[model samples]
Target: MRIDKYLWCIRYYKTRSIATKACKEGKIRVNGDSVKPSRDVYPTDKITVRKNQVNYELIVLDTPKSRLGAKLVDIYRKDVTPQETLQKLDLLKYSKEYYRKRGMGRPTKKDRRDIDDWFDTPESPENKDDSEE
Candidate 1:
């Protein structure tokens, strides 16, 4: 099967187009060399996919007829990614928590305006409020 199609069938990518785009960007390698989306994939081929700031290594065991469920993905590929790489992914998740706490959602318009005001400038120090005068 084509590399992109094979990745999609194995659930490596949510859509075939995403797999193809990754292949075109040279983020997918087969057998230690970069491959195009149309490259043929076979049993025992080693695939290295660079995604989410990690290099995920897997060996093709078999090609599926169609996209597989998340639970059945292991049947078509054997993930050989190093433990350290997965650890790094976990670390990345932890680092992002410092920037935004959970359930905060995105900054609201008022929050943005407040931030902008804080950074823009204070009225000249000499421009005191009537109360101060």
Candidate 2:
């Protein structure tokens, strides 16, 4: 099976097109080497997918005739992704949750203040004295 089709079949990606695009972007690797969407996938091929700040590792078990059910997905591949890898995703999510959503326009006054506070530094003694003068 093609790499993209295999990924979709195993439910790694929602659509084959998305899998293909990810492959084209070099987000998918086979046996530690990057592969193209058209790359052939065979049993026991180790796949590494970089998605959402996580590196998901999978060992292909068999090829599927078509997209498998959620419950049947385990029969096609074995997930070997590290726990820390998944944990990082959680940390990243929670860290970004406090930020404003994209396309929401410019920051508000409070947001600006928060940003300023985050970047604000204390003035040196010389600079402080100069300002006082």
Candidate 3:
């Protein structure tokens, strides 16, 4: 199976197009080498997927006939991603909490405009040029 299709089948990506795009962008690698979208995949191949600041490592177990569900994904690939990497994702989540609370959704238009205005405003007296000596 193609690497992109395998990734999609194993549920590494939401869609085959996204998987193919990631391969085109060189975000997917096999056995320590970057692979193209059409690259062939086989059992026991070491696959690495870089997404959202994480490098996920997986070993191909078998090729699925089609996209698998979340529970059935383990039958196709064995995830070997380090525990530290997952901890980092947790830390990143905490860091982002300082900026926005949970369930807040995206910033509203007025809020974005206010933030832009705040940054665009003049610094202060030092930034002003009112010297009349």
| Cα-based lDDT for every prediction | 0.93, 0.92, 0.91
List candidate 1 stretches off by more than 4 Å: 102-133
For 72-129, candidate 1 gives per-residue lDDT tens digits of 9998999999999999999999999977885487986888898798899867756767
> Which residue pairs does candidate 2 place in steric collision?
none
Name the lDDT value of residue 92 in candidate 3: 86
TM-scores, each model vs. reference: 0.76, 0.73, 0.76
Model 3 regions more than 4 Å off? 102-107, 110-133
* Candidate numbers, best TM-score first, in rank order: 1, 3, 2
Whichever of 1 and 2 has more lDDT, that candidate is 1
Model 3 lDDT per residue over 1-133, tens place: 9999999988878899999999999999999999899999999999999998999999999899988888999988899999999899998888988887744879878888987998897657764656533
Report the C-alpha lDDT of model 2 over 1-133, residue by residue, as the tens digit. 8999999988889999999999999999999998999999999999999998789999999999999899999988899999989999999988886676754779888888988999888878999889889
